[model samples]
Target: MPKHISLISLLVVCSLWNMPQAVHAQALIPHTLQLDAENLERQGLQLAQEAAQLGQFQQFDLALPRARLASQLAPNNDRVWFLLGGLHLQAQDVDAAMAALEKANSLNPENPDIFFALGSANFQQQKYQAAADHYKQGLKLKPDYREGLFDLGNAYYMLGRLPEAIAQYNKSFSQDQKFWPAINNIGLIKYEQGDIESAMKQWRTSVEIDKQAAEPLLALAVAMYNQGDRQQALSMGEAAIRIDQRYANLDFLKENLWGERLLSDTKIFLELPRIQAALQQSDN
Candidate 1:
């Protein structure tokens, strides 16, 4: 799955009130005009900061207008355009997001985060190839960016390029051993490839890394159930559901990248009387 949109902080907030005026005047007209433009830019930065702060609080409705105004006021600042793009993404306006992000990329092609954002936009549109290409471009600029690597892996998985997906997942995991999502996704790919035992091992490792991770826990439960370890699987599945009930939904599992084979097994496991009862109990 793609990571949530993170608020960008490329520009620092500036206030005209805190700026020191020139003690000795140069060419008065041009200098005064330049100061006005500078003040507008500073105000734009301030607005952008406010939008980002609101976004951190999940106030996208309020953030969007401020981000839009920020871009209008700071048309030359890539940071403002990037912020606007992020807000558009939050609003689920993928086309608008792409437009703003492309503007930002045009303004500052060296910034990898814009490419990452573009990759996310494409991923949401189900344009897997485009998403992977954008991620590759961003990774070229910042090869060790763990989240970018993970997202690229997801795109590759969606495209059915399993080997490339696994490579990206491994790269992401190498960046931080504690990132269990990468491990969990490896399990997903393994299960899809009919290597049930390998898939179970990967899920086990993911659970070991983060015991509270519901996805891997439930996946392990399903694998164990498929292997005829019904009693223990039921116990584990119950625990996983209690930790997070969303995993009980097959659609949610599919959204999380569970392939058809694993999903078929998961559906059967979820339909078991014990698991169904557990789901009911969790709902209570």
Candidate 2:
């Protein structure tokens, strides 16, 4: 799963009276122009906050420009760079995001979040080893960071390190019991390894933990179908699609890391008349 860089808690709340003169300046100013670095940073923080707020409203296109302006106005501020990187990442521009985050990391090596951001950027780009390294460094700075632990598990999974992935996923669960994805992903690993019983158990546990999640429901349904429990399998699959119609999509199923055998079974399951009717009804 990709991650978003969170805003820092230390932003100084500046009123209109305290707004820097540069707030009225061009969106992307020339670096050679004389400007107070401190004032620029303060204004940039405000702009970054606005950008983050826009993201909360799902106004990503509106947010990116503000975040870019913040980075330009406060070129030396690590937080602005991080904000810029996060906006890019949210927009799925991995290369740009990684470049901005690398700058943030260089500006403040002590900040664990920078490493976490870099790890997520690399992960999205399918650079699993690089992601693992960055997540490791972030975990070294803050051992209990559950997001880092969970994502490190994802990186390990992509690298075919099943044991290491499960370990990291378990660590994430220990840190935050509400995080059902960790347990759900462990089921995925188990399924990939052909441990069907254990996979079922893990998926059941995940479903109990988060009934609303579509992944475990769909996974459990697939496992059931593979086991010849057609009625139960269809029921679960229907429930999964009722919760989220995207579960019917073959590409989405594959993206969830379904193995060849399981995916083959799923393709057959999808061809079933009842399953096709359920999907069609959901689409309608």
- Number of the top-ranking candidate, with lDDT as the measure: 1
Point out the worst 10-residue segment of candidate 1 by lDDT: 1-10
Predicted candidate 2 versus true structure: per-residue lDDT over 1-284, tens digit per residue: 01111111112233234547645433323331234456667778899999999988878899998999888778888988988898889889999999999999889998999999999999888899999999999999999999999999989999999899999999999998889899988988888788999999999999999898888998899899888898999998888888998877778877776667667767888788888998999889
- Ten residues in sequence with the least summed lDDT for candidate 2: 1-10
- Model 1, global lDDT: 0.89
Q: What is the lDDT, from 0 to 100, of the residue 119 in candidate 1?
A: 99
- Residue 181 of model 1 has an lDDT of 96
* Prediction 2 TM-score vs. true: 0.84
Each model's lDDT comes to 0.89, 0.84
TM-score per candidate: 0.87, 0.84
lDDT score, candidate 2, position 225: 87
For candidate 2, give the lDDT of residue 183.
91
